[model samples]
Target chain A: MAQLTFRESIARGIAQEMRRDESVVFLGEDVGAAGGVFKGTVGLLEEFGGIRVRDTPISEQAILGAAMGAAMTGLRPIAEIMFSDFFAVCWDIVANEIAKSRYMTNGQMSFPLVIRSGNGGGLRFGAQHSQSVENWAMMIPGLKVVVPSNAVDVIGLMAASIRDNDPVVFLEAKSLYSSKMDVPDGDIVDTLGSAKVLRQGSDATLVALGAMVPRALDAAEELATNGINCTVVDVRSLVPLDTATILREVSATGRLFTVEENPRLCGWGAEVTSIVADEVFYDLDGPIVRITTPHIPLPAADALEDLAIPSVERIVTTIHKSMNS
Target chain B: MASTKVAPAQSDVAQKIAMYKSQFALRQFETRAYDLFLENYVKGTSHLSIGQEAIAAGVAAAMRPTDWTFATYRGHAHTLARGVPMTPVFAELMGRTNGLMAGKGGSMHLTSVEHGVMGSYAIIGAHLPIACGAAWSAQYRGTDQVAVAFFGDGSVNIGAFHEALNFAAVWKLPVIFFCENNLWMEYTRTSDVTAVVNPAADRASAYGLESIIIDGNDADEVYEVTSRAIARARAGDGPSMIEAKTYRHGGHSRADPGKYRPAEEIAEWMAKDPIPRYRLRLLESGVSESELLEIEAQVNAEVDDATEAAKAGGVPGEDLLMKDVWADGGAAWRN
Candidate 1:
């Protein structure tokens, strides 16, 4: 095992795919010589060279449009939008064109491409750059949505996303960039729809995604000392949701709580909660609870931003109170 | 196989004849579509390329079979020009199971990947950058294949147009941005909304490309200009933009009657219709009238057969509804 940061694992994952498939090419602003804005792609340029690793102008539409066209042809391209929130500038291409092209064309063409973006808050970038819009991509029909919580999952899931035949919106948490973990040596490929059960407990089931996974695990640890054991499940892929595992875990515990980093309104948690409520209504011990960031623009101030987004303290308190009641 | 040798002059004549046949095919196919729409056979709206057959014919004639062609919503002619059989084109417009996209794309989004007609986009200016991307791929693969993007004058003003142009130029991608300047953008005149007289050609300098404008009604001119541009792109000389000045014979869609244009302007353009003009030119160039008439008859017969075949095609089955949503050929999102 080797210790690697989430940012390093991103480059390692992309490099692994590029080495495996000659068709895979990557492009974005400052991804070439500059090693990406977030430095998530630090060593790609030196290893892959300029032909495969390209740096485009600050044109989101062109970046995505080019990637789509390239994907439809012969190349398996990975295009990056600098920030996740920058999707607003080029949502039409992502939502209308890339998402609908294969279906509209009746599978005459398949886009083997991945759109990678730096997503979510906890960085002091404020509203425009920090919003978690994984839900935005989850709603689109033809796209596979993935958000990895740790360095290991990042390498594995990034490989899977690149290998996927359909378009995948791979959202990487900006807050988790510096976080480090030991990943096994050699290629680490994982399945797209499988959610990993991080911690096993009996009292309550906690489903979390991306940045929320680590927090949920911490909360579970703290809740255990208070005599309330919680099971934490990391939902890696949102589109091809592993409802079998989720429903099984929820049914086993007979109580479920969602920990979401995204805003409360129609978040991915809502979808999971709805499915659990509908399918296993009789198995529930109490009403399912959701701990999420409030439905408001993320504030710039640290205190307000921390208060808005769900914290480890909040998750423990909510699950503890609900279980006790 | 027996070897057959032909002179260069004869080869040129053959190309011209093929272009003429393509033009005839587009005109007849579009005329049939119009009749079908009136008879309620063609469901939804259709943006016809009735009077602008020369551009599609000329561009297709110049392109290699492997070259990719991207067209707009007004793209039945462009699709047919790539030698995609009229049956699938007709069936797609009519929304039948045998359609080019199995009735998924409808009239506005006909696509035939086997024939290199990548897609027919409905959104204005969206496919320009996409075409550039395809061209970028070809360049990366070190192929002589070129990508051509076809749009109306209205697309010139969209942000994607400018972005695609700059992107292609910066990367020196092998793409041709072909703008069919059909005078009107829907109900309004393109000239009123556009800043320059030639929407595509005049803006070429901003992207370090030569400005070019052709008489879209003249098949010979379109063929020659497009051939040159294709050669330049194939030779790695970078992208080119061509503005073909033509006029649409009808309104933007089947719904409008096109009363918005002045009577005199309409009459002038109708008189310059590409079909008759190309036929007259062919006759004047020592091509026998009998030969031209024979070609027209063949196209008419073929179109008639295709229309019948499309009408006979059934609606799509329920199984196809949930298929092809993902690469797995199923729409199962949850396990």
Candidate 2:
């Protein structure tokens, strides 16, 4: 087993995939010589050379468009959009073309493409750079949205995404990039659309994604001290959601609480809550609760931003409130 | 700006007219298809390709089967010129089980991967990015296959069009953006919307791409410009934009009569009808009139056969409604 930071894990996975498959190539603004803005692609250009690990112009549309085209033409392209917030500049390509090609072509075409973007709001990067927009991608059909919280899961999930035939929106939490964790070194391929039970409990089911997974784990530990045993389930893939696992957990606990960094309204939590209500409403002992960021845009002020996002304390409190009620 | 360069390999008027006759066959097919559609044989809304036959014929003639081509709603001519069987195309428009898309994609959406014609989109400039992506894939694979994206003059103003063009130019992808500048985007004239006067190709310079403006009514001009663009693309010289200046004689759809177009402009454009002009040119260049008549008769017969086949081809079975949504044979999600 090798202990690696989240950034190194991502880089290792990409390098391994590129080595394994000659068709897999990486394209981004500074992914070649500069090794990405966060060094996630460091030393890749030296190893793979410029043809495979290419540094594209600062056009997000081109980066994504080229990746889609490349994927269609028998190349598995893993494109990096520097920041998740920048996806707005090229949403048309992502939403319409990438998502609709398979269904529109009557199964004649497949977009085996993966788009990686750094998300979350902990670096004091302000509103433009810090917004969590994974929900926007989750709403679209024919796209698998994966959010890995740690180094091990990131490496495993990314490899799976590269091999998957469908297009995947891989969202990486910026704050968790430097976080270190022990990961199995050789050929780590994880199953997509499956929730990982980080810490099993029976009192309440705490569902989270991306950065919120760690916070939910922390909250579950804290809740254990207070006699409230909370089960933490990391929703790795948001689209083809692991509803069976969620339903089993929720049914066992009889209490549910979802944590997400995005705004409360129309966030991923709402979708989970709706699923639980629609599928297993009668099993719930209490109403489902969602601990999410406020409906306002992410603030530039560090304190305001911190307060805007859901924290461990919020998750713990929401769990307690649901248990008591 | 004219330079005395070496002549093309085939500039004979007879060859040009033969190409024009092929285009006329496509035009005749579209016209007869529309007539059948009005007579209640074909279901769904039909978008005519009355005046833009030359653009499709000229461009398709210059492309190889390995090269990719995509088009907008006015895609019948493009599909026909790309060698998709006429019966299947007409059956598709009529929503029959024998259709190309298995009767799923009606008039607006047509696809034939065997001919390398990537499906046509109903959206204006949506296919530009897809074409760019496909072209990029070909370049990445180290192949000489080029992608051609055909759209209307209105698509130039769209964001996807600009974005795709800019990306293609910067990446030097093997792609050609062929804009059929038919002067109307669903009742809005290109002149009324855009301030640019001469050719829509002028916008290509802004993206640092080579641009060519050709008389779309002239099949030979279209063939010449598109051939050069295709050669440049295959040679890895990067993407080019060609604005084929043409006009749509019919309405935007079956519902509108194209009331927005002026009678004088329509008359002037009709005077340059691509089929007759090329025939006259062919006759003047020593091709016999009998040959032209024979070609016309053959085209009419083919169109007639296609119409009869399409009419005889029964409507798609109700069970087919659930087919081809996904490749893995999954049921279509009703929700």
Candidate 3:
């Protein structure tokens, strides 16, 4: 019933979960006293106290490892790794320990941990702080990777991630943190591995995720004005991808354009394109197109960063090219 | 949970030494278990702690059953000393259905939750952060239980080690980072790679931690220092870094013979062998030779029994290869 930004929705989701379940706790740099660098956890510390809302040292490995241990023992820890790039510092713990714990111990252990981090390259945070590392997580077997596009989806996805019995990598796009939307009142629980179709059309299907989802919607609207009705689906979850929905949409449109902010090579978009091509090749009228950032490190310069990332215009162009080809 | 006071034994030094010999019996049990693995009765690579028996026996003697511990690849000594039954540990190494991890984890990755031995990781320095997390949990739950992480010197140089220590120091987690500086990281000498030559304790100061460099060969010294650190951690003082300066008589793995070490250095360390050193000390402190021989015979019989039991327990079933790949929820997306 109330309008809230994506960032505020996440904070409310975490706060509600922490209140309902005493096992839920927050840990990360600047998450407690400072309410996180982006203010997503602004008032949590004051409400939960230092024990529940902890300000951890700037050690990504320990932050993740500690979360894994706590999750295995009995606590559900929502750990924040300031930036997605810093995830590399603790990949071994994430991939080897947390992800594989449930399987490695033969179902004796379950890592019910939620690892939240900011990703994407819209802001000039440079190569170190920027870049979408969801593809790396998608490569891992046991992890469930989610990247929500708006306030409503963020709230829903965050709750699902917290409730998941396995480890989940929740990537919050920094560019979409301040974006506002009117979310429905009462509790909202969304299912994992499901996609949302924002716009319905028959001309082409546009698959996108995170910050790129909004851009694809805008592109769909612009194309609608010209009678080129394009369908836009927000792939909120990456690892357990809703291929069933994606395939049905692509089969109807006969043209596909996958959009992502990550580099083109081995990106999430590439994987989606491959899956669609392999499964529904005969249904497609033309070759699948992927609109993504160039395969290079993100630059600090504004103009270069803007040019490097996919835009609405790029999505529209990619859609037209796929239709024409 | 209320604190349980476990006072240190105040009997004569001879009695303490005898208790430690019982702890060594567990390590000897694992050593003989390795023989089953070596004789092809069990499958998978095995890393035995045949020579470094005192380190595990002494450290675990000072720890309570509730305290948490994690070890590296060469973890049989730590697991045995931490009170995991010899049968399951050997069965896990042999990949049996009744193994500690249900045949999912092999030699390098053995875990027993009942014993508070969380698990042993094969990756260098990877478990340091996990150990810190366990310690944090204990402190958060208002428990006085301490967490100990045992790693070789090679792990001290990894990024995870630095990150884990920095976090442990900042949060003052109840943890004891025990570094076994066995003078070598695989084939390379510690001097050839590490910038700090004194010991891992010297580097602890950089992280603002209280460090103690003890003669790891002397079991009594290890027990005394570790007991103090554990006590300090239980009292909420903070984490401590301990550099147990010791040596490995065997090679890094079963394949290598440790031919890289100088004969003179090996002889020098062998002269201060921990088992013999403790044995002599016990004999001089009023323990009779007959009692020592009795202890040895008892341990030898236990080792023989463990080996026989492990050999009788066969390898895991073929259908179990894909059993533990994921939790019982559902299949994970492979694409």
Candidate 4:
């Protein structure tokens, strides 16, 4: 086993895909010489020539449009949108064109493309730059949304996303980009839509997404010391949500708490809450709780941003409240 | 394919006449489609390509059959010119089960992978970057297939148009930006809204691309201009643009009568209509009048048959709403 930072694992994962599939090419702003804003693409330009790793003008529409068009033909283009917030600039293309073209084309074309974007809010990049709007993308019907927690999951899930026969938006947690984690020694590919049970317990189930997974684990470990053991599962991909694992965990514990950075109302947490409400409501011994940020734009200040996001303390508090109430 | 260049002689003349006949067929098709839409036989509206047949027919003829094409809402002529079956084209507008898109895409979203009509975007200039992507794919896959993006004068002002052209030029993708400068961008004149005198080629040149302005109403000129660009792209010389000065005869949609257009301007363009002008060119060039009439009669019959078949076709099944929404994900992918 080798320890790798989240960003390094991303570079390794994409480099592996590009080596495996010639059709896989990387394109975006600062993806080339600048090696990506967070250095996720630090060594890609050297490994792959300019033809494969291109630095595009700051046009997200063109980037995504090219990805959609290339996917329609034979190329598997991995476009980086720099930040998930920039998805708004090409909102129509992402929401309307790329997401709907396959179904609109009647399964005649499989959009085998990946859009890697930096998401989440811990760094205090302010309102526009720091927003977790995976829920907005998840609302679109024909999209596959993936958000990984660690280096191992990021590498495997990214490779899987590149090979997926559908359009995928893989949002990397900017907060965890430098965080180091041990990944498997050799080649490892993770299955999409499969949730991993990071910890097991019977008191309650804590299903989280993106950076929230580590935080959920943190809360679980703290709860473990207090004798309130909990099960923690990384509900990785929201679109092809591992509802089977989610239902099983919730069924076993008779309680469900979804942790996320997005706002509470109608966010991804609501989707999980509704699913549990519909399918496994009888299995729950208590009401479903969602530990999420308030429904407001992310603040620029460090203190306010910290308070706005779902911290480990907040998840622990929500867990205890859900356990009792 | 035989040399795309058209000369004043035997087989070349025959190819020219073939293009002429195709333009006539598209003209007839658009006319009949508009009539059906007026009669309410075809559901929804259509942006007919009545005056812009030459650009469509010429560009489609200039490229290889395998080459991809993208267009805007005014794409019935484009699909027809690209050789999509008239039955499916008509059926698509009529929302039939056997339509080009299984009745899902309708007029604005008409598409056919087999015939190489990638998409007919309703949003102006939105498909430009997508067209660039197709070109990038062809280069990446090492295929000589070139993708053409067809849009109007209004699209030239949009950011996507600029973005796409820059990307195409920077990447040297095998794509052609065919600007159908039809003067009017849905009732508003191109000059009224745009900054330049003729928006054609100016935008392309801004992106450091080789561009040319041709008489869009002339089928032969369009074929010649687009053929050179496509050949250049195939030779790996990169992207080029052809701004074809064309006009739209009908109003923007079924609703508009186009009172905003000056009578003289519309009259001047109507005199410059591509079909009759090309017909005269063919006849003066020693092609018999009977040949032209025969082509017209044949297309007329084809349009009638298509209209009848489309009206007689069955509606989309109930599962239309449920199926094809998620090709590879959405719960089915869960393990």
lDDT (tens digit, per residue) of candidate 3 on B1-335 = 11113344344665466555755675576566656757776676777776677778778878999998888888888888877877777777777777777678788877777787888889898889888888888877888989899999888788889988888888888999998889989999977888877556777888997657877777777777888889999999989988887888878887778999999999999997788777887877778889888878877877777666765775666556666455554555642
Candidate 3: which stretches are off by over 4 Å?
A: B1-23, B33-38, B41-44, B284-295, B312-319
User: What digit string (tens of lDDT, one per residue) describes model 2 on residues A85-108?
Assistant: 999988877887777766656677
Question: How are the candidates ranked when ordered by DockQ, highest leading?
Answer: 1, 4, 3, 2
Complex DockQ per candidate: 0.83, 0.39, 0.53, 0.66
Model 2 docking category: acceptable
Worst 10-residue lDDT window for candidate 4 chain A reads A101-110
Off by over 4 Å in 4: B1-11, B328-335
Best by lDDT, which number?
1
Pairs that collide, model 1: none
Candidate 3 lDDT (Cα, whole model)? 0.83
Model 2: fraction of native contacts: 0.38
In model 3, what lDDT does residue B25 have?
Answer: 78
Cα error, residue A215 of model 3, in Å, equals 1.4
How does model 2 score on DockQ? Answer: 0.39
lDDT of 1 by residue, B56-130 (tens): 998898889999999999989989999899998899888898899989998899899999999999989899999
Cα error of candidate 3 at position B221, Å:
2.8
